[model samples]
Target: MSTPDTLAFRFFSLHVVRTRRLGPSLVRVTFAGDDLAHFHSGGRDQSLSLFIPAEGRTEPGVPVEEGENWWQAWREQPDGVRAVMRSYTLRALRREPDEIDIDFVLHGVGPDAAVPAGPASRWAARAKAGDRVQLIGPAVTDNRAIRFRPPEGTDLVLMWGDETALPALLACVEALPAGTPVRAWVEVSDAGDVQQVSTPADAEVTWLVRDESCAEGSPMALGAIKQAELPPAAKPYVWIAGESGCVKTLRRHFVGERGIERRQVTFVGYWRRGLTEEQLRELPED
Candidate 1:
């Protein structure tokens, strides 16, 4: 029952049929619809743009009648558009008859927060068996590749992120080569924000928590990383993502100061403090 439009671009129409709490601040929403059949199955660290329709609206925030020209329709919409689009990593993709599951990391309350009790989170929280919405982007191809394919003989993998980047972290852990040496540093708002992550037996995972006033950038994870002794193997791959400032600091330290080769590390500014996703998107390339 899927339409050609669904496969044409990374966008699709979806209906939320189930929801679950993965942790205090994280929620996983499972969506299904005929359009899901066209979903691209690119794994770990892959991100897609979700276009959530406004409340009480039956049609998508952007018209699907544009077929492959949906983005044009979105730009040309009269009342502008009643939708909120957020960038989210595709944590996992499972193929079924006509559906897919997209897990979203729900950040807490605030105007700058991507889903702060906004239409996307609200709909996901209350979504029943029949609720429908529109999804867009992953946008076919951005300059950055969706999945990372490490070079042969990669001895170790180092990954670091805050909760905002957890979906990508989870996907990376799940897809890494079996028994690959891994060191992970994850920062969370509070101790309770930590969630159990499954990684290969050889992987070493560390959870860093910030106190009430500290939040994520309290230098906890960065300090730990500074003190950590990396395996003495040449050409270990590093993947870092989180707040822009924090990530930029690490990038400066690792790639800028330490002289690590750029290709050996992937640093992403997943989000930034005080900036909306749109603002973050508008930032110049580093």
Candidate 2:
């Protein structure tokens, strides 16, 4: 929220243009606004802090000034009057109409859901055209929020992610250069969440669907990667994200067990099991 004078990031007021169901558990929300003309991103796992209206509110409450102290002002507001903020990835951006797409994983929205849906999921589930929101996103063509960086001299790209990270994983894949070799594993709660990825890169994507046999919040990535055969590459870059516990396990597998250099791998904990987003933020990173 307190950006440097370069102001690589800034706030944008946007409204939902449409919503499309990608699968039983995923929805793509497209947003457009006059302010998008100033938004810029290098793509590939770009992060955004979205502020949605609080429950029963028609629009989000944002800071009055777009200054370095905007975060302080927003945080000082009464809890009931402040907007609910959540982190999400940019799925796609189009220039013709100045629109951007964000994919939301609708966790716990079904009748038999074991856990109740969170505010962001609930909001995204019912999002309709003209619904207003504000987001803090990149204003520079290249910024730090985009984390899927494969360093120079990398021979192969490896990735693993769960439903919560699918949007980012897909964006990274779509941005790879032509003929780049990539191996990716995506785990989803249901087979319906599997998607078609189009990319110029030579990417091999494997979808792992959890059924009744797989335990909730348990990771399948470690075992799957252990048994699989990876294409030999001297310098391989790895990216893993999803639940915090699973991400740590996979990071260990790649760095500690597989002997991949720690610096060559990027891991993000999108969420932690049994913890609310605010609760997760309060805890120190492991």
User: Evaluated with lDDT, which candidate comes out highest?
Assistant: 2
lDDT of 1 by residue, 1-286 (tens): 1222343355577877777777666777777777665566555777667777666765557666767666656656655355656767776667655545566555554455434564556656555666667766343433243645566888888888888788788778877767888888988765666777676537888998765466556487778888998887787888888788888888777787656778888887767888877566667766
Worst 10-residue lDDT window, candidate 1? 1-10
TM-scores across all candidates? 0.83, 0.94
Tens-digit lDDT track of model 2 for 171-264: 8998899999999999988899899999999999999986646664545667788887988999999999888888888888999988999999
Each model's C-alpha lDDT?
A: 0.69, 0.88
